[model samples]
Target: MLRNIVEEHFDNDPDVTIAAAKQIRRMDRDYADVGDKLYALQIAKGNRLLDEDDLDGSWGQFDEAGALKPDAPEAPNGKRQVLLAKGWKEMERCYHACPDLAIDALEQIMQIDANFREARSKLYALYVSKADRLGRACDRDGAFPHLMRALEIYPEGGEAQQGLAVCTPTPIPTPPPAAPVQVPTVTPRVVLPTPPPPPPNSPTDISAAPNSPTDPPVVRANASSAAHPAEKSARTGCARAEQSARTGCPVTEDSWRTKLITLAA
Candidate 1:
């Protein structure tokens, strides 16, 4: 009966509500067990503080209720109404990109009533939004805490599930094996120079005729008496005389010749 009076005047008359609370405590043999009534008195005081815009004092009372009965619903002292209104206001903050204030209000609403589904849903959505934005920015590790919080609220939510997947540690791609170190093996190629065409009417070195196919063709000469090569006699007798004299050929003494051939006609 005393409790009913407290509820009716909880927000309207602080004096009357406090008096009613005292009366109820006196009437009950085990008043200490009436935690709900005590909680109501605290909420009434908090509402009075809130009415005066004394947010700090009101917070103390509300927090006390949370410490005592965290799962309790808001009291009849306009506490429920204030929390609901404040929650929406904070949501507006969120829209304006003030996430910190928005999150604080949503959490407060939950402290007032743990079963507030709208607050939970919105809070979960906000957390997921932050996580996704951060993940897209290559902050996957930083994004995980937000997704984890969202999951704690709604374990079955698809958004958080996908966000968790986004935060999952992915295997770094193995770099394409460093392009095999190219050693650039240099093969030593022996280049043989092409032998100059036999001098205009001169015979090629006959000694070179029986050599290997791959060998360079050769020419033999004698130092000329003139600035130019001296022509040799084609006489077979000259060769015989050279053989008798121990020279290899009429033009010889076993010598080879080459020219840039600036003299080519």
Candidate 2:
């Protein structure tokens, strides 16, 4: 009885709706009998809260003691009747006469009376509106979960089932290959000059270089080069040509080989 009274008080006050809903659930499994005055007061207040656009308005007025109530006051049934009329008017304006408020009102009613199918149907429609909105958002993934939840709540609901099918993303298609274009090719008319020979290394300069002191000390020309036959070449620094001593191609002349030996010495 106390719990019912508390919930009724809360239903009359939009600010207390959450607390009222909680207390309403704590009441007797069938709400037992908390007095018709108190029960009807809570139901009417709950209806007003659902109807208000702000969803923050009070469901009922005040008492002689100056105490506020969420639901209608019990001692003055006549005053409660007047308040209920006002609440209904406010609800009608806030809800735009849509059946949406019916679902909210029914939800509260179900807490007091579990076997209320009228409220269940209204709640189901609310779910449909929510699912439809979700499906149209960039995060369509979010809508799928709600749709599944709605299906769980109403397994026979065709809207929920149909929405699930329509929201699936379409598969991407493969495009055909583009035709290839022919590009002009150019032949070289001028040959680049061969690179100059690298400089010779000095024994004293090589010795001053860093290395493990314990390693064998040696100084030698660190030169490297490669050349192909039929190419005219110039000698610079310590370079000498020995025809590559290969079998088939034009070999280095004996005179060039002699000059290379002299440079090494």
Candidate 3:
């Protein structure tokens, strides 16, 4: 009846089954299989708690199961299932509110099971999202590490590739010079010839000579004889007339009168 009670409480009440098994072990020293029965009951209780999402309670039950039978595979497997469930729950709760914590949770899941329920994809997306936010806030230096990590997670991710390109730095360039100016030349002047002066005055120029006060007043003899020629002729005729009268060789009175008239003429 006690063994049947232990078997009946194994699924529904593991604690009752544990108490019944302990009482059976105490009553009959031949009941050596109670230890194995106790281990099974504890593993059953841990699976029940894991299904209820009671990670702490499940961990305690599995720990006790492991202590009962250290070489048991059931306890370790149950603990692993609990850790996976806990990590997934934490990541879902804090992914938007606290992304860093969510990222840590996903990374832990990766260590346990790399392909655990989109963990690698979620981690890659988180890194890319952090990098994008930092880049938009003008913190490219801070964004580089996250972008690099994202690329490491997903080498072929277009978003991560584009982000890395945006975060990288480049160089600048220079300019050219200007040209020169021009000037003109000047010309020379010309010269002319000079003319000659006039000649000097001669001694024949009467206007150049002045009169002397002591010069004698000269008279012309031809001018004086020409002016009295008729008077001298009349005087000569009178002398001839008087000499004829004195001579009186054949002096007729008529001849004497004729001679006088001729002298007068």
lDDT of 2 by residue, 5-119 (tens): 4556554553455344445545643454433434454445544544553233333322321122335345255343344444444434534356456445544544554344344
lDDT of 3 by residue, 1-265 (tens): 8899888988777788878986897798468687789888878889989999999999988998898789989999999989988999999999999999998998899888878888889999999999999999999999999988888878989999898888885545455555555556657666565655434664566554555576544444775477687887676677667776788565456776898899999
CA error at residue 135 for candidate 2, angstroms? 1.5
lDDT on C-alpha atoms for all candidate structures: 0.71, 0.53, 0.84
- RMSD (Å) per prediction: 20.1, 29.4, 26.0
Model 1, 233-255: lDDT tens digits are 34534665766578544443332
- Candidate topping TM-score: 3
Model 3, total clashes: 0
Winner by lDDT between candidate 3 and candidate 1 = 3
Candidate achieving higher TM-score, 1 or 2: 1
RMSD of 3: 26.0
What pairs collide in candidate 1? none
TM-score of candidate 2 relative to the true fold: 0.27
The 10-residue segment with the lowest total lDDT in model 1: 252-261
Candidate number achieving the greatest lDDT relative to the actual structure: 3
Candidate 2 regions off by >4 Å? 1-106, 167-265
What is candidate 3's TM-score against the reference? 0.57
By lDDT, highest first, what's the ranking?
Answer: 3, 1, 2
